[model samples]
Structure formats: C-alpha cells, structure tokens
Target: MGQKKRFLLRLDEKLYETVEKWSADELRSVNAQIEYLLTEAVKKAGRWKQEQGQSEKE
Candidate 1:
C-alpha cells in the first residue's frame, strides 16, 4: 500500500453518529468507511482512474 496522508476531520455530531452506525453495519471502521465513500464519489465524478488489471488503490 502507498503511504496515506492523514489529517484531522471535523464532522457534525449527527453526521458522525450516522457514519459510525453505517460503518458498523458494513463491518468497517469509521475511517475506512469515510475513505470508501470518498473513493466511490471520486469514481462517480469520473476523476478516478484504475490501473490496468489492478483494483483501485488508496
């Protein structure tokens, strides 16, 4: 895996709670869920490119 740049994220209380619950339901940590959502959004926006014969990288 490539190095990941980390920083603080401040979400509203209700948003955090909602994400926490969704993450749990999907068996993912809160951070992973956020990354997954962001990645999906990027792909949907046509800004993400996939390497040939390889899955998406984070």
Candidate 2:
C-alpha cells in the first residue's frame, strides 16, 4: 500500500445515509466503499492502468 492523500468531502445528508448503509452491507468503511466504487468506474471506462495494478491510474 501507498501513503493515502487526505482531503475534505461534503455529501448531501441523504446520499451519505445511502452510502453508509451500502458500506455496512459490504463490510467496508465509508471511505473504502467510495474508493472501491470510483476504482470500478475508472476500470469500466478504460482509464485504470492494468499493468501497474489497482493503485495506479491513467
């Protein structure tokens, strides 16, 4: 693993609640859940660098 960058994120109350529930169901923290979703989206869009593994983006 690499050092993670941190920043502030603000979400609508309803959206946050939905993500909270989904995160629980998936047994991941809210932050991890969001990261997972974004990673999948990037892969689907052909933006993830498969040769470099999941942590790299292109």
Candidate 3:
C-alpha cells in the first residue's frame, strides 16, 4: 500500500463549486474528484508515469 500525504490546496470559488457538483454527480468525494481530474488531465497530456519494464515483465 502507498502512503497518503496531506496538503492544503486553494481553488477559485466558481471552480470549487463546479467541482463540488461534478463530485456529487460522480458519487465521489471532492478530494477524489480533484484527484480524478488531475489524473485524467495528466493522461491526456501524456504526462502520466510508466512503470519500468512493465510491458516486458507482462
């Protein structure tokens, strides 16, 4: 299991409300929704990490 880290984050009021609504619709907590968004953004930008030798091992 990976360790969880805590940090304070700031958001614009409008963006925060938008995320809250999206979170409710997706049945995820606000924090989870933010994480999901970040992950997806990274994926689309080709910034997501890859495990070393993952394909070869598989």
Candidate 4:
C-alpha cells in the first residue's frame, strides 16, 4: 500500500468539458486524467520520480 495525497483544482467550464471528453475517449476516469496530466507535467519539469515497483528489471 502507498500513501495518497489530495489537492483541489479549479477549471473553467469549457476546459472541464474538454477534459471530460478526453477522459471518455481514453477510457479514463476524470481523476485518472488529472493524475496523468500531473505526472506528465512533473516529468516534463524534471521533478517526477519513478517508483521502484514501476521500474523495469535490468
């Protein structure tokens, strides 16, 4: 098991709708889309971390 962090985000109606559509198209829940976006952002910003469980065995 892992710890969880919670955060609140605010978005305009139009942006929200876009994300809703994207989530549906990708078969992901709204929460999942947000998490995916955050993960990408962190990686792009060079602040993301790869968990040991997620690493490929060498």
Taking every candidate in turn, the Cα RMSD to the unseen true structure, in Å, is 2.2, 3.7, 3.8, 3.1
The lDDT per prediction is 0.93, 0.87, 0.86, 0.83
Candidate 3 — which pairs collide? none
Best by TM-score: 1
| Model 1 per-residue lDDT tens digits across residues 36-58 | 99989999999988777786653
Candidate 1 local distance difference test against the native: 0.93
lDDT of 3 by residue, 1-58 (tens): 1576889999999999999999999999999999889978987899977677565223
Per-residue C-alpha lDDT of model 2 across residues 1-58, encoded as one tens digit per residue? 5689899999999999999999999999999999899989988999976655554543
Angstrom error of the Cα, residue 21, model 4: value is: 0.3
Segments of candidate 1 deviating more than 4 angstroms = 51-53, 56-58
State, as a TM-score between 0 and 1, how close model 1 is to the true structure: 0.85
Q: What is the lDDT of residue 54 in candidate 2?
A: 54
Residue-level lDDT of model 4, residues 1-58, one tens digit each, is 2777888989999999999999999999988998888878878899966667785221
Backbone clash pairs in model 3 (N, Cα, C under 3 Å; residues 3+ apart or in different chains), count: 0
Question: In model 3, how large is the Cα lDDT of residue 28?
Answer: 100
| lDDT comparing candidate 3 with the true structure | 0.86
lDDT of 1 at 32: 96
